[model samples]
Target: MSTVIELAPGVRAGFTGRDGGVSREPYATLNLGGHVGDDPEAVAENRRRAARGFGLDPRDVVWMNQVHGADAVTVTGSGPAGDVDAVVTTVPGLALAVLVADCLPVLVADAEAGVVGAAHSGRPGMAAGVVASLVAEMERHGARPERCAALLGPVVCGRCYEVPEELQEEVARSVPEARCTTDAGTPGVDIRAGVTAQLKRLGVTNVTHDARCTRESTDLFSYRRDATTGRFAGYIWKA
Candidate 1:
């Protein structure tokens, strides 16, 4: 079953629950991103299906060329940026969409303030402070830090997502609390844990996690889980 986490009554967000649309083999079905070697037509149709599922205007959903950096753009209009890792908007009906494979697609909203934001938190971007950057921009739009709630969408959980020692060291240096190792001697970084601690430090009101491990679950698209795979999206919009 597809799951959508409700941070508050008016805020709605979820990962693209698999098992629908048209794609093949590596992509299988319900692959929403076009850049992953899927058929363009199939990708377009998949996106259309997602729009219909979310009850959103397909054209109004904003996207960005993710560079895995800490650049968050504030959307005062429709259209996207060239090198943005996150998007925040106070405008209604404009859904902020982030395409992710194993990376965390973070959704944030201030229901009462009519503000919503989405961030692409891969290794580099999370290390560079993408989520924090987005939260800062959301505050600029009149969303109080203590009133905005965040949802860490489906991603590669620490257990299934392993990393090299150097990379783990880098994560620890960038954000000290990012390391989460298991008793079996598997060393890795937990993006959710790191980001959650950062959010708390920023005074974010509420932060809830979807708890779906993309790499471990075949239901969600994961590049790490399936070497070459489709991108399932996690998006949010102000209504």
Candidate 2:
């Protein structure tokens, strides 16, 4: 299932949970990523179900290769957008989808400009400035940072995101807000905090996030918790 919100009068955005699909076993249900070893037919059917849930045709949804890099691209149509972490579009009725298990799925929309963008930011992608890349693409399409609203959600939270101190320091060197100490006193990285800080610094103050931690929530998928699990997605479009 999905929980949706209107970013603006005509723009819609939502994140999906790990339910309502035909995948079996570890994937269980609602596994949308095609390259994740789930049955290809199951992945395709799940994607179609997700698109239809948003009243979109399966062929009209735009997806990405998602290498967890700092690259973002602009797309005018559906299908695989590119080997990028984010996809931005000004085309109405074109939905941008980002798949993530523990990583952050960030959705951006500038209702006034009719532009929407989606990014998949893991700790690496977050430190690498993928969100910045997304905002930059949105700006290129007549969207002003201050006029954009962003949604971050269903991620692996700070408490469960323990990391090596050196790696944590590495990420902190770039996005200080990501540095965290877990309840157990180990270094951790909070992707949401880091992303929110990045967005605010870039003049995007309108932000909303889900407090649910994928690792902690059974309703969502978590790679850290289940090594070979399914991936849910966040989608944005103008309807």
Q: Give TM per candidate.
A: 0.94, 0.98
- Candidate 1 residue-wise lDDT, 76-174, digit = tens: 776765589989887777888889988988898988888899999988888999988998888888888798889888888887768888889989898
Kindly report which residue stretches of model 1 are placed more than 4 angstroms away from their true locations once superposed.
Answer: 1-5, 182-184
Worst 10 residues of 2 by lDDT: 1-10
Candidate 2 lDDT over 1-239, as tens digits, reads: 77567877789988888889999979979999887899999999999999888788899999899898999999998889889999999888999999999999999999999889999999999999999999999999899999999889789999999999999999999999999988799999999999999999999999988789999999898899999989999999998
Candidate 2 lDDT score at position 231? 90
Best TM-score among the predictions, by candidate number: 2
> Which residue pairs in candidate 1 have backbone atoms (N, alpha carbon, C) closer than 3 angstroms, thus clashing?
none
Q: What is candidate 2's CA lDDT for residue 107?
A: 93
- Candidate 1, run of 10 with poorest lDDT: 1-10
Question: Positional deviation of 59 in candidate 1, in angstroms?
Answer: 1.4
